[model samples]
Target: MRTKLATAVGAAALIVVGIGGAQQASAAPKAAPQAGLSGSKTWGNTVGWATCSGTGTFRVKAICKWEGDKHTSWVTLRGGSAKLVPPACRFKIERIGVHQSV
Candidate 1:
């Protein structure tokens, strides 16, 4: 009777609320970007060595290519130089990218 009908209505309301909560979570904005390197490069030769130097509140990433292999290394620069020696297969620096923090 009335009690059963009320219980059913309460359950349906809870279900709707739950669905609304899930939708809000799914619609949430993406994460903000942090200080890091952004960009790319294409070296024509084996990039066995690479370095990054700068003066700022940013991060540097050196992308290197060795023979037919490629790798990436990262470094945070406050006001100096940062060097990156990729894995054993990397031979030269093909590209360098920087990202500054807000």
Candidate 2:
């Protein structure tokens, strides 16, 4: 008799735990979208082949290097697309990064 009572209580406890787990899983929040750095490359005398995507404001930054000179280049992006144009001197991209803005 005692063994049957213990088994019934254990089964009831398992049902209650399973219901709580199901409710918590259904109520969980989804993740929000975020921006990211896509890629960078040289094209002719410009650095226009850079790409970025996803949500929020972002900036694509690059160092344009030519001979003995290098300068900072960047482009502001919103949600979808943007472009980066360095100084119009025969140059190549030496380094790159992404920055989130307000």
Candidate 3:
């Protein structure tokens, strides 16, 4: 009887620990950086390319929107220019936005 009680208590404790771990993971922020979009432009046809520029001391976040899809990511700028490569070919770039966090 005592052994069964101990086993049940241990199992309950493990369940609580597992739930805590899951909650922590869900609370963690996404890998994407938080920033603001300043300006951006796209070029090319077959293999499209893009450049995003912004004013911020930290890294910049670029959100690219295509036909019916959207991609959010971070880019490091050199000389105020950050290059972006689309995920697919012939995907019309509808909009590109930049973000910077303070």
Candidate 4:
């Protein structure tokens, strides 16, 4: 009887842990600036693209590309490198119009 009780307890514990894990996995990650912020440039293609408000995981990954127009170059914003408290966010660039006007 003791052995049976122990087994049952273990099973119950497993079930609880499993349920918790599932809930965490299924829960939608809250995204910061949860809308088009017009400054969160994720990507671009010579002309137009999408922009985000900030950077962070929000049930989906952030991605954008842009061409600098005398201001930024090769601009991009991505998710955090670690589990960010507020989340490290920035715009990345890989070009230099240098007054060339991208």
Candidate 5:
């Protein structure tokens, strides 16, 4: 009886240790993707473009619209500019917005 009880207790203790190790492993910080320039704009005579330019830690969003088609783009930047241009369509700058990323 004593040996059986000890065996059960040992198994339970091992399970607790395993759970703790798993929690610690999951809690470890994960590497984030490098923040950089992404996506591009289409160019044309009728295709209008809107640029959101700024410096410092922030996000910039630009919305452009044509007769019925619309395009939107955004970027998170430490310091740079992001442009949104409609593809093969006459678009006007609907709006440009900026907000702090942090």
Candidate 6:
């Protein structure tokens, strides 16, 4: 009876340690992707394309129509003919259209 109780206690302790270790392992640091020249990134917050997009260190009103999340995030941009412009190499933002890529 004593041996059985000790074994059970030991097993429970090991299980606890194993679970803790697993959690810590998953908390390891991860590398972030490279950002483009227009580095106005807001993760969950949506901003006007002018607010986010860039045009030679300035924001263009006509180009500002392209509004959405950062390139790191997934967005659905579709409407009329998609007119896109590459403000940055990583992603090609639309210049004129119903939806913008950036």
The global C-alpha lDDT for each of the candidates, from Candidate 1 onward, is: 0.49, 0.51, 0.48, 0.36, 0.48, 0.34
Q: How far is candidate 2 from the true structure (C-alpha RMSD, Å)?
A: 18.0
TM-score for candidate 3: 0.34
Residues 1-102, candidate 2, lDDT per residue (tens digit)? Answer: 999999999999999999998898566332112334354444444343345554445444445565433323434444565554434435665554444544
Q: Considering only N, C-alpha and C atoms within 3 Å, which residue pairs clash in candidate 3?
A: 35-99, 35-100, 36-98, 36-99, 36-100, 37-98, 37-99
Lowest summed lDDT over 10 consecutive residues: which window, candidate 2? 28-37
Q: How many pairs in model 4 have backbone atoms within 3 A of each other, for residues 3 or more apart or on separate chains, i.e. clashes?
A: 9
Q: Candidate 6 at residue 94, lDDT?
A: 35
TM-score of each: 0.32, 0.33, 0.34, 0.31, 0.32, 0.31
lDDT by residue for model 4 (26-57), tens = 55333334442223323332222233333432
lDDT of 6 by residue, 9-97 (tens): 99999999999988984663321111221323221122223223322222222223344313222222222221222233223333421
Clashes of each: 5, 0, 7, 9, 0, 0
Which candidate number maximizes TM-score? 3
Residue lDDT tens for model 1, 1-102: 999999999999999999998898566333112333222332344444344455434433445554543434334565556554444435665654443444
CA RMSD of each candidate after superposition: 13.6, 18.0, 10.0, 15.6, 16.4, 15.6
Candidate 5's residue-wise lDDT over 1-102, tens digit each?
999999999999999998998898566333112243333333444444444444433333334455544434334555566554534444565543333333
Model 1 scores a C-alpha lDDT of 0.49
- Compare candidates 1 and 5 on TM-score and give the better one: 1
| TM-score of candidate 4 on Cα atoms, chains taken together | 0.31
Clashing pairs in 5: none
> TM-score rank, highest first?
3, 2, 1, 5, 4, 6
Stretches off by above 4 angstroms in model 3 are 33-102
- Residue 79's lDDT in candidate 2: 52
